[model samples]
Target: MRYVDFTSEELWKQFLPGDHLALDTIVKRHYNLLYQYGCKFTRDAALVKDCIQDLFLYLWHRRNTINETASVEHYLMKALRRRLARALSKSGSMEGIGFLEFKDVAASPDEQLIQQEQKAALADKIKKCILQLSRRQQEIIYLRFYLNASAADIADIMQLNRQSVYNLLNDALNKLRQHTGAYFKPAMALSIILLLVLSQL
Candidate 1:
């Protein structure tokens, strides 16, 4: 059935019909993206992974009752966000919920070693700057820039009004600029700042 060739919505439709292959395909396609997004909300990789597993299981079990959706990625992300929040809330340990730890990738060879080291240092700096923002601000930046979510999509995912999303995003960017002043160029673009932030992810 070439499940790999199916669009997300197509896979979703197949899944609704109790097709295990379709469900597996859906998981394989979205797992990495979901895991990365989930990690931005919490540092516990295990917890993020568990929530994603549970999310898919819940969807599979409730396939008959779940309505169709135009955007499966958005639906899954919103569900996972809610699930993680509930789990964290019940544990009463939301203190370390906004940081993404830097991942070290090995340099290919000595010639590029210096360049890789510089990039790693910059990524670490951006990660620290992001960690200093409020949880909501970090999330807003992640959604808007990392995911390239439109203001309306972010409003839906974060459950904020579009205007509020704009306000929060503006405030977050302002704070990021101040925090990054030591390393940032006076005219560096916000998109570039975010791209550097994503380098570690």
Candidate 2:
């Protein structure tokens, strides 16, 4: 059926009719993204893995009741978040989740040694600066820049008003600028910052 050429919505339609291939394609395409997003909530890799499995199982069982959607990724991310939250809450150990952790950014071997060192240093500094933000601020930054999600998508994922998403993103950027040292070109600085942050993911 050339699922590669199918839009996510089309694949979703096929999945609704109990097409195992379509469901498999959807899982293969989104599993990594779901795993990464799930990690943002908890460091427990096993828990995240189990939750993702459960998410897919739930979707498969309820396929007949699922609604049409333009973005399968968004739907999956929102569902995963809710499922993880509920699991954590039930365990009464939700307090430690949601803190941002830094993964070491990889350096290109082709880059000059000095240049690589400078980038590593900058990434370390940015990681420290981001850790200073509130959990919500870190989450907003992650969704907006790292995930490249539109404000509306973020609003739906985070359950915030659309305007609130914009406001919060702006405020998070401002806080980042305030906490991080001055850069002559704010726009360029932001690009570099997001690049370094995303590299870890």
Candidate 3:
């Protein structure tokens, strides 16, 4: 059905009408993103995969009742987060699942060689600084910068007020700057660059 060229909104609309191909495309497009987000909460790959499958099954069963969202990725992320939280709580492992680990950025050999060592070092430091933040702070930073989510989308996903999301992001960025010993401008610039690099993977 050439769903590959369809926008997320179009695919979602088609799915709501019980188009199996549309649903399949939607899942394929978003599965990796949901899995990465799920990993931020828990290191158990099997558990994360199960929760994502459950989320899709639930969505398919309730397609007609589901509300349209501005961003399908955000909606799926929020749903997956809720599903994972419930599963973890049931297993009494919620406390062990909130840490966010930073992975080394992937770069082509040419790109890696072109990047300055000092800039790479600063980016690495910024990544470490992000890990030092509280769990909530790290989540907000990931959503806001890495996912390029709007404040409203973040608030919806995090179940917080829009203003709270803004405040939390501001606080997190401030902490990153302070922890890195960089001025606000440079810290922010470095963070945006590093996050963009990480998000590509």
Model 3 stretches astray by more than 4 angstroms: 96-99, 103-115, 182-201
Q: Give the worst 10-residue stretch by lDDT in candidate 3.
A: 106-115
Kindly give the stretch of ten consecutive residues in candidate 2 with the minimal lDDT sum: 106-115
lDDT of 1 at 58: 96
Per-residue accuracy of model 3 over 1-201 as CA lDDT, tens digit each: 688999998899999979988989999999999998899888899999999999999989998899777788888998999899889988997653464555665433334423455555656666677667788877887777778888988899988899998888888777767765642355256455445346545
User: What local lDDT score does residue 183 receive in model 3, on the 0 to 100 scale?
Assistant: 28
Q: Candidate 1: how many backbone clashes? A: 0
- Which candidate do you rate higher for lDDT, 1 or 2? 2
- Best candidate according to TM-score: 2
Candidate 1 lDDT by residue in tens digits, 15-130: 99799899899899999999989887777899999999999999999999988888888888889988998888878877424434334433232333235555455445666766
Against the true structure, what is each candidate's TM-score?
0.78, 0.87, 0.85
Q: Write the per-residue lDDT of candidate 2 for residues 1-201, one digit (tens) a residue.
A: 699898878899999979989989999999999999899888888989999999999999999999889799999998998888888888887753464555656644325323566666655666667776677777878887787889999889888899988887787677666766653147556666677666767
lDDT of 3 at 8: 93
Spell out the clash pairs found in candidate 1: none
lDDT of 1 at 46: 97
Cα displacement (Å) at residue 27, model 3: 0.5
Q: Which of 1 and 3 is ahead in lDDT?
A: 3
Ranking by TM-score: 2, 3, 1
